[model samples]
Target: MADHTIGTVADIPQGTRKIVVLEGIKIGVFNITGKFYAVKNTCPHQGAPLCEGSITGTILPSPPGEYVWGRDNEILRCPWHGWEFDITNGKSHYNPHQCFVKTYEVSIEEEEIDTVTVDTYPVNVEHGKVIVTV
Candidate 1:
């Protein structure tokens, strides 16, 4: 796949998402705890716009009659049918490997600057700018 630069890390906040259209294909780029993930905007179930769906946590059964919610902003719920999908790998909650949405690889490009330390050792430190390539 060809690499496309969506934006810098500052463009997307720590708990938000951005949608980028590449060659007529809409892809969702999400930022969860500073990590980036990309997924196809179309939902597998009914072709709904998946990226427009709500980013929420999963509901788990804590006991016989109790339910607990966790993993906030880790799950994407389809707006049409409420189908939950993992944003990290686009794995559907219902049929993990059998049914799922398409996911793209996301990478961060950082520039390095050379500097000298007190011990006379050369050090390369990352600049503030971060390029998000997908």
Candidate 2:
């Protein structure tokens, strides 16, 4: 893994998306509810920049025989085609088998955001902000 320093934690606000260039790759960094996540900036459905999409919650089916519902708010909706992706795993909610985006490892150090790459890009969170380093 390779590490890179992108920016400070105050740069990104919660529930907003930011785009960065990491290792010449376009990456999208999101600060959702004080947490950070990273994924490919482009949407696979129509090649749109996912950073401009809507951030919303997702409903998941409970385990069999359970009459409860589990919900997650880490989903990003594509602006062009409305395709939804789970930010935590970078997998498409609509087509779980074949659709996925490149996700990066993120960490913080001394209130500074650091990103680690895994053949794709690197992203991190620092001081409550999101950062991406290519």
User: What TM-score does each of the candidates earn?
Assistant: 0.78, 0.69
Q: What is the clash tally of candidate 1?
A: 0
Residue lDDT tens for model 1, 1-134: 68888878899999899999998899999999999999999999999999999999987758877789988898999999999999998999888988888899999998455786764444454596544433
Indicate which candidate wins on lDDT.
1
Off by over 4 Å in 2: 62-72, 112-134
Q: Find the number of clashing residue pairs for candidate 2.
A: 2
Backbone clashes under 3 angstroms, per model: 0, 2
Can you write out model 2's per-residue Cα lDDT over 41-64, one digit (the tens) per residue? 888877898867888877667778
